[model samples]
Target chain A: MNHTIDDQVLAIGIPTDLLSTTVESLRAEILPLFDDTALKYSQVGKVHLNLCAVNMIDSAGVNFLVGIIRACQTRKLGITVTVKSRFVHRTLLFLRIDRHVELVVAS
Target chain B: MRVVETHTSPGNILGVDDDGVARLVLDQYLSRSGFRPELATSVMHAQQIIEMRPPGYFDCVITDYQMPEKSGLDLLIWLRSKDPCLASIVIAGAGEKDLVAAALRNGANNYLDKPYRREDLEQAVNKAVETTRHRRELARNEADAAAVGHLQRHLLGGRNLAIPGKVHFSHHPKRTAGGDFLNVHPCPDGALLVLAADVSGHDLKAAFVSAYFQGIVRGMLEKSTPIDEVLSFFNHCLWSDWGDRSAVTLEMPTSLSLCAAVLPPGRGQATLFSAGFPDAQVVLPSGEIRPCGVGGGHPMGWFAEALPERKTVDVPESGWLVLWTDGLEDHARQLAVSPWGLAYTLLRRDESTARRASIGDAIDDILVVAVALGSASFDEGFPILADQYAGDRWREIDAIQNEWRNTLTLAIPALSEERLCEILICLREGMLNALKHGCKGRPECTASLRFQYQSKARNLRAWIDDPGPGHGFDWASHAYVAQRDLLPSHRGLSMMHHFASRIENHRHGASLTLDFHLPEPP
Candidate 1:
């Protein structure tokens, strides 16, 4: 697992093999970042997150992502999640999460 | 050794070869097997044989691959295209892998190398015959499925026209058709039977029960069976066939809530029969509305012994009788008024020049007013505006006029003059009261009204409801004081009191139920 932060943006890179487990950990880890002073000053259009390296997401992982999106929305901050796998794109589309968040496909 | 004679079925095989010598060899093989086979010297000769005889002239076709003008694959394709079920075998002097594969793909049942064993020919014939039979069965099933598709479309399609003069009707199907059904049928006696019923459940099985109920009711009406007997027969049928077997618990109420009214053609009185449904209403000539009730009984199609109560109300000449499904009543109650009040307001507003203009331009004009008041987004003041204008001010007044004209034309046959006027007055007053007092400044406050008539008692009733609490002012005391003062503004309350036989508050101040009697018939 690799996590990097630049300005108010957070990027988490996980190997395809541990993608599901890494998403679960990152969802929990991302909450504390919102409380940080550097992130608090961010405007709606400034907050951006990348999960591009994740390949497989089950229902649980998808649910965690939805929770993060909702929390970000309540604070009036804009967040974008990058998904590289077609499976993830299809899963998000089916669940209608695509309607609420900007989905960036790396491929 | 003496050969056993075997009789071959007619047209069982066709043997084609180019050389006369090959034909001689086939003849010898046929005699040895104690059977007969047709022989053709060339492709043209085989064609000539087929043209002369009708189809099924031969059961199995055995042909050589190498022939002038046409190959074995060509003949196989032609025969199969003509009749897909036709079976054939191909034989060739030189065995080519590509040719064999192509021949089989083109529908050749079997292929043989030129130097073939005698037993191979017999085995090929047996397989071809079996393949032809299987293909025929598949064709039959396809035809059956097509027929079923046609029948389903005809039965479940929503093509029936809306019968004129009905109020507050909704068929929100849980499925294609549900346990609840309403049908208006014109009887041979020139009378109309309006039937509203609710079957047991909410699925396809429930739909079947509804269909069964419809058939029985229609039969009884056509036969002029007594209303009570119709209910009894339907109840007995459901109890015996469905009561215990239904997916719902045996104790679960498996009954239909029904209201049936028989209206004679022209301006004659109607006989009503009801079981477990909401009350019925008759709109009188003077615009007053009233409720008509039948003694209660279990809904039809419930228990075997459950008897339905029958009540007859003489629908006054030139008046209208309104019956409704539970959905309409629920929708009315949800709006905090009797469904009759909504009907009354609609009828009353329908007669106004401004509101009638709206009806001329669009049927949705009426629906829009009802929807706006019912909407939570509309503030209390909005309904007041609506009550004054009868609709949105943005809509063109001329267009509203056109819509009302059309609505009147459509509704004229079902409505009587006096009933129409009474409904309009009640609706105007009710709407004004809701707008001025109930919703005032709150945009979210709502109100609705329903008007109806009870012909037997010659009475009209209006039910008015608002989201706000009832008026703190005493209407009876107010009426008495207004009479004493002789104030022009106080005339509305006096008029309302004089026009109606009784006015009562219900559900606190949320609803006002008013009733008025109709004039006796000539």
Candidate 2:
């Protein structure tokens, strides 16, 4: 996971797999960027996750995503996930994750 | 056709006159006009003179009307039959209107009256010479094209040696020389390799490039270079070498759509590699057709990174592997028929149908090759696609799902993109469920996936089998929990139920089958 902060928005690139073996490492890498103390004055109002590389998401991956949605809710920051794979998009929709975050199906 | 202009050098003329004085006068007039005139005493003498030289060597034939033995009209008719393009002029009597009309009707270039002025004779000779020059150029072009076509047919469409499978191909060029080309190579490992390719344009230059490509392939394959590596080398040559040259010299860059297949002896898998070519079709013994590759490969010479898509396809005993270029698909689309159907029909050589007639007049060049894998006949179902996955490597689910999507998409091209995604989602969820629960993430446990298409029933079926017994949970209850309560744990089960048309549990839930109804072929 790679994240860049610019213009009050944090953009993150998701890895290819969000499965049981790899989800915890991604969560560890991604969750801290949300609550960094130095960002208090930077005003990061939105979070954008680029899931273009991801195609499959198992239960552990879904739970990790739900945790991120909750983190954005607590911080009062809008969250959007961009994806190119239809499977990832449909999985997020089926899990009701779209209710908390904006989901974009990129062409 | 080149327009021939004989202004600088007046053409050769054959002058026929019974009167020795008239012959001398005609010869002197022709010499003044910068023309070489060969004088003949009569029509028989003119025929002997004309036959001695090659046709059209004597550009114009000038004969006096009402001559003894063969008349001027008779000479004009004979010259017309011998060389239809040879120019002929008839000298008629001043009062003979019927004779002048008959000479013109028998293919005379012009008519001259007896005691005609020198100017009239020179003007007729000038016009006749121009006609002869133009027609001769056209005749030469036709002869060249026909000869090139004969060479292409024997070189590119020659019969192949007897190999493990039955291989037959049909190539129809719209013009005498076409851009499409194909070649069959017998591999040293008791296998057959076939190549079907189409150059960018339908012209002689395109044919030349095609022949050049075949020569390169033959030379490289003789050294036992892998087909994929050969294609990669070609792509590099096109992108770096020809690419730069064509950019500087040609109005538009040339490209090629290529498809190559390797079929081994006996009941072995056939590997197909495609670059900007339509997917090859696999026809089972029961007349069931399944597409063999993922397709959508970038054509060679288009990009430096245009690597051909390679896929392993099962060819059962007594089955067929049909390969073709997009020219057939383009023509088949216009005819509102399946390309595979047209290709199969062509391979079988069925001429009683309208498709065969349409193929004869295709707008583009078409090349098709069909190989029968074995000689035995069997009437059982065979998996068009089959794969095995270890549960411990569950992280490869994405790659496995991608293969499934490609195979299904190629097998049933009629499947809409949206529907295809949904079906793939279902298969992915099922495989994940099997890997997690049934195999328990054990390295020793493996799961198998297979897809079969039944064209007669318009059905596509996928079966997923796991080593362990399936989980005993009620799928309906889990689906209800996901739908009603929005729980994340059972959401995949819900998605599978929503996407797959029907799901059947077999072998105490160890094996699961999914069926999808296909649309009628157009």
Candidate 3:
């Protein structure tokens, strides 16, 4: 398991089983960790968001990712997101938001 | 020094003061000025006296600015807010300069310290009342203007087609609302009634006449009135309405040129009715034109007593009916040719496939040309025939009528073998005439041919309308020579003359209407 946290950045790589439930629960639980730094780092520069975990993003999970992107932009932060799943890339393309974000494929 | 009557009515003025000096100094001044005044103990009593009387009962309000819970400013605000037109003056004993300014801004007609003379109060009351009357008049005029706009929109009916189909229609008024109206409505018998009318004049009066005709036509349609009866009823109603108005006084009589149709359900059949409008045509599938007969009645609403005759013809299937206002006819005539050029332009082919994609597409193409030619407006592309010269005008009318006849002639190929042969024979004669006579002067002179078959009547008509000056064959002289057996080459004319029922020279072209009773459908 790997976990990294900084002033406006969070990267997590948990076990596949833990990732399944954790990703679903993190939308509500993890949002508060960045609440304090949200206003501080919002106007500074681009915010790096990396999630390298056991992968598959459902419709609801995709919606959570979009919500985070919007919150970062409202505070004037550019976002760079990386996902390993082909499903996530397809969803981004389907939603037409892929053009606005940098989507990196995990090797 | 000088005393003025602050209140015109003696009963309205209360002379009570703070020291309980009722009628002491004020009454003496009022008596000297030849004016009587009423007395009140407090502000509450004075308000009660004013309320008991109707508006304008008191000439002025001269009250102390301070009294119990209600101060003079409060009374002034209440009076101005309620009437805004009420004339009043505020008199304050402990007059602070800022407080006096506040009282004036709060709508007190005038503000004065307690030591102020009676003449000052009287002047303020008169000025305030005069300003109020002027403001009220302006509001009344604005209200009247809004009402007129509302009425015009209601009369105009706005731009919305009642039913959607291959045809599109519109009418534009140059004024708030002009006398022109176009209506499309479903009749009780499942037929669609389409009417376009232009009433005399461009003002509200003309619009009223148009609105009246719209109602009458709709009513007649709802009652299942036949096509002819609808025109006749409108004629009768307009005559009755406009005749009485112009009879007693020498005034311009109101009238309308109406073109109306009742399109039956199915592909191409409609019962058309027109009054003093340019001739309408039925374009057959094969591209022959047939002129719809027009009655010799004056336009609707023109005469006190005139009977209109209506002609009915069974429009063949796979044909298009083109109706026009006089504007379109004039435009065609002005160009010194018939609308054949327009029809050809609209129905032009790529030479590879001489096929019309759709009836709707044809109408759209022609309309585009009409607009480009400045013969029509975007909203309603009815050709304006009045602007065209007489000689040029009739040619356009004949051309469009001929084109309509040609469309039917072209459609005959699908009807039956016998009918097809008859149509071909007529077309053959027209083609030969074009090759021989039309192209003689200038070998490059081109002529087009259209053949139509009337299935119901079992008749075939062909039109070889040409742009050339005309054939020098002298049709009448040839008929004479053929009768005398003098000319040898008169054989072709003799053959066409006997073969076709009628070969008529139209204003700018010629049309050949042939009667072919096809042997009977198996």
User: Pick by lDDT: which candidate is best?
Assistant: 2
Give the per-residue lDDT of model 1 (tens digit) for A1-107.
45556665655454442222345566566676656464565422344546565544443355456666666676766767677666556555644566677888886
lDDT of 1 at B6: 34
**Model 2's chain B TM-score?**
0.65
CAPRI quality of model 3: incorrect
lDDT of 2: 0.75
Interface RMSD of 1: 31.0
lDDT tens digits, residues B27-135, model 1? 6665455445788877777778877878655667788888888787778777776667767788876748688888899988888887776677667766765666556
lDDT of 3 by residue, A1-107 (tens): 34355554554343332111244566655466346464464433555556455343333344456566666666666767766655445444544446556777777
Most accurate candidate by TM-score: 2
Query: Per-residue lDDT tens digits of candidate 3, residues B385-440?
Result: 11111222222332443443344333322345324323333444454454445554
TM match of model 1 to true structure: 0.37
lDDT of 1 at B3: 50
TM-score of chain A of each: 0.72, 0.93, 0.67
Candidate ordering by DockQ (highest first): 2, 1, 3
Error in Å for residue B312 of model 2: 2.5
lDDT per residue (tens digit) for residues B258-299 in model 2: 888888866568888888887787767644566776566678
TM-score of each: 0.37, 0.55, 0.34
Candidate 2: tens digits of C-alpha lDDT, residues A29-107: 9867877574577789998988898866666677677777777777888999898877778777765677668899899
- Regions more than 4 Å wrong, model 2: A1-107, B1-9, B19-21, B54-56, B93-105, B112-120, B157-165, B244-250, B333-345, B348-360, B376-522
Report lDDT (CA) for all predictions.
0.55, 0.75, 0.51
What does fnat come to for each candidate? Answer: 0.00, 0.19, 0.00
